[model samples]
Target chain A: MTRQELFEQIKIKQSFLCVGLDTDLNKIPSHLQKVADPIFEFNKQIIDQTADFAVAYKPNIAFYEALGPKGWESLQKTLDYIPKNIFSIADAKRGDIGNTSGLYAKAFFETMDFDSITVAPYMGIDSVSPFLSYENKWVILLALTSNEGSLDFQFSELKNGKPVYQEVLEKSSKWGNPDNMMYVVGATRGEKIGEVRKIVPEHFFLVPGVGAQGGSLEEVAKYGMNSRCGLLVNSSRGIIYAGKGTDFGTEARKEAKKLQGEMEVLLNQYCY
Target chain B: MTRQELFEQIKIKQSFLCVGLDTDLNKIPSHLQKVADPIFEFNKQIIDQTADFAVAYKPNIAFYEALGPKGWESLQKTLDYIPKNIFSIADAKRGDIGNTSGLYAKAFFETMDFDSITVAPYMGIDSVSPFLSYENKWVILLALTSNEGSLDFQFSELKNGKPVYQEVLEKSSKWGNPDNMMYVVGATRGEKIGEVRKIVPEHFFLVPGVGAQGGSLEEVAKYGMNSRCGLLVNSSRGIIYAGKGTDFGTEARKEAKKLQGEMEVLLNQYCY
Candidate 1:
């Protein structure tokens, strides 16, 4: 999807919420395991319930890959089930050489048909450029991640006082504009969100680490928001696994609705 | 496979050669496409031919993943076919949060039964720790990549004058001991291999860009080699697609044998 289209969706829904389908068979309700493909079934219900509130759905590829061929089948099913109007992201942190990355671009963009795929920037331009080849498709590069490991190298000060991620932001911005590129800035680094905004004010930021990871949504909106509401705050476990019982779908909707309601206010205050 | 076992395999084979199974449908011979599963069939033939000369088989995961479900099935078959003595690497540069990285660890190590999976170090400790959780399995973190993009952020000088890749080597060494951890130092960065050796001398280095990518095996062996012949120099397109005609297998084996012959000399000169 185009940046304008994505921004439009955020405006129309009044929520830049992206529900992460980190669907694990063991975590889903045990009753659903009786089905041939429980992960898909669980995701279908979760997507169905949360679709209205979420402007996007990101299927964490690791969850699907763990199950092998069956997992991939479930992933394809989940991708197909997501509403076309809503943006879909293959949260597959994939990057390789130019040729190999092109194949990945094809896997997520052409074959699987995700609007975006998360890419790691460690390999640099060639590894990421292939994903940017597609029109309207997005490459959500890992800028400042939420994990504890983020401190090990991400925050390393370069020779010019630029943090490694800032260097990543600066170098990568030349490869693609805000239209086709987004950065994954962890909401756990809430205070630093402003730092990221200062670098790429126009580009969208896919902010993970909200409820379960202890990132405050209000802080993210306050610091990260732009004129186009340039933020996609993702809540995976917090929303999908809101309840383990049969009413899990309803419970998930409740959580998503709660976030959406807050996002609606933020959208009105910032973008709208 | 255990570190000792890997060393033993290298000694027995007289080569630390790793054949990269970057199988693509478009790249393989047309005659093979007539088969039910050309990618697997191609891999099976390559493995059968080069199994004696090579100590490891590294399947570049993106190639298979691009084909969707059928590609995954082909990958499973290929994995099952590889001899137990030969180390298997899923070149799936994957990394995420702790939980998600755990799932990825399961995907490559448990479900797929790969001995190692290439990991991107942008996320830090939690993203890498899960891969280290498995006994005997390896996490070959991206240290200094072979591609031109490696110059982008990997070579950034930190506050202490340590290059970014050096920092990656220093910090990640704590996550996994030499037994379970490895670093991918691209063959293209042949001169820098000695610098990497100084940092983590005992750990194995999965060196790519050897043949097709213009990396000198002699330079890699000279600088990167350790007491255990700690290098799995990979040659993908050069060996696998050596011949597109009917004699593809024979040509591939010829290339493998040639590399193996050179590796044998290096082993004798260095370790023995």
Candidate 2:
């Protein structure tokens, strides 16, 4: 999808919600446990139910990777099942040496067909540039992640008086423009998102801490929104695991609808 | 494998050489192309020829992941084919939030049976801690990589007068003991390996860039060697793809033997 296409999806849906399909077999509803490919079934339903509200689906790759080849198959099926208009984000934080990274780009962008992939910036230019070569495909680099561990290295003070995340944003932003690049700015720190916004205002921010991580959606919109509605606020456990019964998809839809309704208000209030 | 076991393997072989199974289907000898599973067949040949000289095997995951599920199956077969005594390192630079990291741990350590997995430390402590939970398993964190891009963020000066890699070494060293933790200290810059060794004295360093990437084996041994001969010097293309003809395995063995010969001389000169 192009930058304009992504923004158009947001406008058409009245939301920039990116529902994370962090599917774990142990966490799925009991009724679905006996199915042939339970993980895919669960995700198929989640996509079916929440497609109306969500503009994107971010599948945390680790969840699928845990189950080995079978898990990868399930992931492929789920990707094929998602509505084409809804953007796909492979939340696989992968980076390596140049040649190796090119292979990874082949894996996610060519083989599996993700519109975007989350990449770690620690390896620098070559590790990330391979993913940017594909037109309409995106590279979501990690900036200020919501995890507590983000402080260990990413938030450290540099001699230049800027935090390491700022250094990451400043340099990495030059590697790819807003059209092909995005930043994973955690919503756990709304003000920090504002700080990141100031660093790279044009690139889309894949905000991951909006729901279960206690990031207020309102604060994210107020501080991080751009004229393009440059944010894809992600909610994983909060929406997918909304209920324990067979009616889990309905419960998930309810939670997604609530967020979408709020996002509609935020889009009108902030981006407009 | 435990630290003592790995060290014992190093002593037994008199070569801390690690064979990197960066098996690319397109690059394999044309004869293997007719095989049922050429990737695995190629890797099996490489491992068979190199095992006597190498103390460890590091399979670069991206090469396999690029092939999708079939590639994943080949990787599992390759792991199963490796000699039981040799250490296995999944060169999968994976790390995520805590819960997701745990799943990655399950993927590489539990499901796949790798003795260790390379993890990118940009996410901080939580992303790393999960991999350390498995007893007798290792987390080889990226400290100083060999690529030109390593200069991008890794070598930047921090406010405390230390480079970012040093900060990673200092903070991350406390998270896991030397027994369960190692560092990927690239050998592309020989002197940089020495600097990393000083910050992280006890833990083993999986040193890449010895051959195809152009770092001297002698320089790596001189600067990066420790009390336990604490270096697993990796040579990927130089050893594995040494010959493009039908006698590729024999040619690979010749290259590995040359490195092992040098390593034996280094072991006697530097340590015992």
Candidate 3:
């Protein structure tokens, strides 16, 4: 999806929350196990309940991959279940050799029907450029992550003096315009969001690590938000797995609504 | 698998080639189209034909993901098709929020049964750390890429005066020891291989962009090889899709044998 379309969705929905479908078989309510595909069953319910509250649904590819063939079937079914208006992301951080990368582009953008897919830019331009070739498709590159280990390399001072993450943000910006390229900047690093914004101020960011990871939505909006409400704040475990019982879907909707309500306020304050 | 196990495989085969299963449904021969899952059929044939010539089989995740439900099924079948003696990799470059990333770890290492996965470390420690938590599973972080666009950010001079890719290598070294972590250093960036080695000499490198991208195998081995044969040179289109006819598998085997033969000589020259 183009940046403008995403912005429009955010404006229309009065929300910028992107619900993450990190579905786990074991964690899903046992009552749904009898269904043909428990993972898809869980996702369908969550999407049904939270569709009104979220502007996007980001499915981490790993979760679907774990269930083997059955898990994958559920993931496809879940994608089919999502409302068309909401942006869909295959959160698969993929990058590789050029020909190989081209095939990957065909997979995520042409075949899977996702609006966007998370990408790792470490392989440089070729690895990411293939994804950008598709019109209206987005490539969410990894920038500054939100984990404690982020200190291990992201913040490390390079010989040129800038942190490694800053270098990625600056150089990778040239590959595609803000319309086709977004970034994965963790909400946990709220203090550094301002710095990230300066690097690619126009691009959207898939911000994870909120809710259960302890990152504050207020901080992310204050520092990272753009005029377009260019932030898809994701909350996985705290939402979908909010309850272990039969009301898991309802509980997930409550969690999503709470975040969406806050996001609406944030949008009003910053999305001018 | 640990670095020791990977090295042993390389030694036993007398080669360090990692056959890239960047399988595309459209590219498979007409004979294979009759199968329920053509991508898997092609991968199985390639694996069976070339297993003796390769130490590892790296399946780029994009190919499988593009097909949606069917693509994922093929990926699983392909993974299972590979012999246990050969290292298997879900070339899914994944890195995300911590809790979600932990689930991704379970998907690739625990569920799908891959020995390692390609990761984009742009998210910092939290995104990568979860993948590293798996015992004997390796995280191949993006380091220096080989595409023309790589010059945009990967080579950009950081504020600290070093290039961003160099800093990524130096900082991410601490996340996992050489045993658990590897780096993706493109073969196209031949000149910089020596510089990368200076930063993380012990870690194995998953090098792509060799055959089709015009990267020289001799140059990569000369500058990048360490005492442990620290490289898993990959070739995708130039090998697997060498021909588009019924002899595709035969052609793929021939291409793999050529690369493996070169790799065997390199291993001997480097005395690994």
Which candidate leads the pack in lDDT?
Answer: 2
Task: Identify the leading candidate in terms of TM-score.
Answer: 2
Worst 10 residues of 3 chain B by lDDT: B151-160
Per-residue lDDT of A1-272 in model 1, one digit per residue for the tens?
88888888888888999999999888999889898889999999998899899999999999999999999999999999999889999999999989999999999998889999999999999999999989999999999998888998999998888899999999999999999999999998767999999999899999999999999988899899999999999999999999998989999999999999999987787665
Residue-wise C-alpha lDDT for candidate 3, range A43-82, written one tens digit per residue: 9889999998898999888787767667767777888788
> Which model, 1 or 2, shows the larger lDDT?
2
TM-score of every model?
Answer: 0.99, 0.99, 0.88
Identify the runs in model 1 with alpha carbons over 4 angstroms from their true place.
Answer: none
Q: Tell me the spans in candidate 3 whose CA falls farther than 4 Å from its real position.
A: A1-9, A157-162, A189-191, A198-201, A224-227, A269-272, B1-9, B159-161, B189-191
lDDT of each residue in B4-118, candidate 3, tens digit only: 7777888888888889887877778998899777888888888878998899999888677767667767887888888987888777777765766787788788777898988
The list of candidate 2 runs beyond 4 A from truth reads none
Q: Place model 2 in a CAPRI quality band.
A: high
* Selected candidate, larger DockQ, 1 vs 2: 2
DockQ of model 2, rounded to 2 decimals: 0.92
Residue B7 alpha-carbon offset, candidate 2, angstroms: 1.0
Task: Name the candidate, 1 or 3, with the larger TM-score value.
Answer: 1
Q: What range of 10 consecutive residues in model 3 chain A has the weakest lDDT sum?
A: A152-161
